[model samples]
Target: MKISNQNKTLDLTYPQVMGILNVTPDSFSDGGRFNHIDAALKQARAMIRDGATIIDIGGESTRPGAAQVSEEQEIARVIPIIEAIRLESDVWISIDTSKPQVMKRAVAAGADLINDVRALTVDGALDVAAQAGVPVCIMHMQGQPQDMQDNPQYCDVIDEVADFLNERIAQCIKAGIKRENIVLDPGFGFGKTMAHNFRLINQFNRFLDFKLPVLAGLSRKSMFDHLLSLKVDERLASSLTGALLCAQQGAHILRVHDVKETADMLKIMNTVASATH
Candidate 1:
């Protein structure tokens, strides 16, 4: 499978690494690290060199109870980086936002995909994404970021997530977004308990029922903290293991922080699988 925009196409026959570029000062992990244009560009270049095919840029911190930034502030934070990156490279750029104005500005600047955790539920978001003509990754979050993790309840985690994503897919199609331009994410830490997250990973392949690309974004999440009491910086091994599990289950995109390590792990896994075949 492949996802394309005006600038490039990403082949998903093999899993692809999407390097995270949080251009915010308060993201739970790696915040305040790349908010500067120079620093952000440097990280983007390094991720690309390290084998990332996509650079996901987020201006706002969506961590639980995170403070919100205005549309102007968000555009200011992300647009220059997008423009600067476009000047030097054609790597796929995904704008991680739910605001319609930000989505419009990011795409106009050079973003190739809209990776909204809100699934385009924000007013005007659906229309902006449909009009942008880029691939859209809709994630399932039980509630708004501020309180999503407060008391997330699900009768059945997998089924509920699947149902939510299915409904979003229908809404996107109804909004004129083509079926092929959609991707699905189970949303690892968005509002899930540790058990809910583990269950999703174990049954990750269930999302393939739609036959669309699935994106796994469990890199350095709090789930590791819950499972092994590991700090964010100390979760590399756990993160890589989660990534491999998702990849093995047919995830098309691995959204992560450790680009080089994840890329190397996937290379090794692919090499071994090919040898057996």
Candidate 2:
């Protein structure tokens, strides 16, 4: 599928890496590392140099039990970085936010996509995305970020998530956004137990029923931490493996912190896969 974004069609058949740039002090993975405008722009340029096709800029910490960031704070944290990156590079930019206000202003600052963890379910979010006319990633989170991780359950995790994405895509189309401008994410860590997350990650390919682009964000999640029994710094290998599996399962985008390695690995893997086919 070709995802329409920023007046261009994004090639979604081959998987690409979206380097994560969190301009927050408390993201679950790499927080405070890129909060400064210069630092964030440097990281974005480096990711693009390493073959990152998209740079995902996030201000709020969606980590479990984290307090919500006000719209003012969110915009303050992201707008400068978005502006700085646009001036320094031409890589696609995705504002990782759920607030309609932030989404609106970030696009004005030159963001090409909206990577909302709430999947545009927040109030006025649909209107902001529809008006901006950029691709919006709709992820399936079980509940609010504050308490999503506590006692999460689903009758059938994959099917439930897939159904939720299908409905959200249809909702976007009805709201005047084109289908080609929508991407679906299974929301790996948003509100699931390790087992549930694994179940979804292991079988995410089944979500192809929607036929829209899929973004897999399993980079450095708690599932890898739990399985590897490693500290946050030691999960790089596992993260790469998960990224590879996500690509093999039809993920068009692998959102990650380790962009250089993921890009190199995808190159080798793609070459081998093509040879076999």
Instruction: Encode model 1's per-residue lDDT on 40-148: one tens digit a residue.
Output: 9999999999999999999999999999999999999999999999999999999999999999999999999999999999999999999999999999998888999
lDDT of 2 by residue, 138-200 (tens): 999998988998899999998889888888988899888999788889999888899998898
Candidate 2, after superposition: displacement of residue 124 in Å? 0.5
lDDT of each: 0.96, 0.90
Q: State how far residue 262 of model 1 sits from its true place (Å).
A: 0.2
Off by over 4 Å in 2: none
Model 2 residue 228 distance off true place after TM-score fit, in angstroms: 2.1
Candidate 1 wrong stretches, greater than 4 Å: none
**Top candidate, metric lDDT:** 1
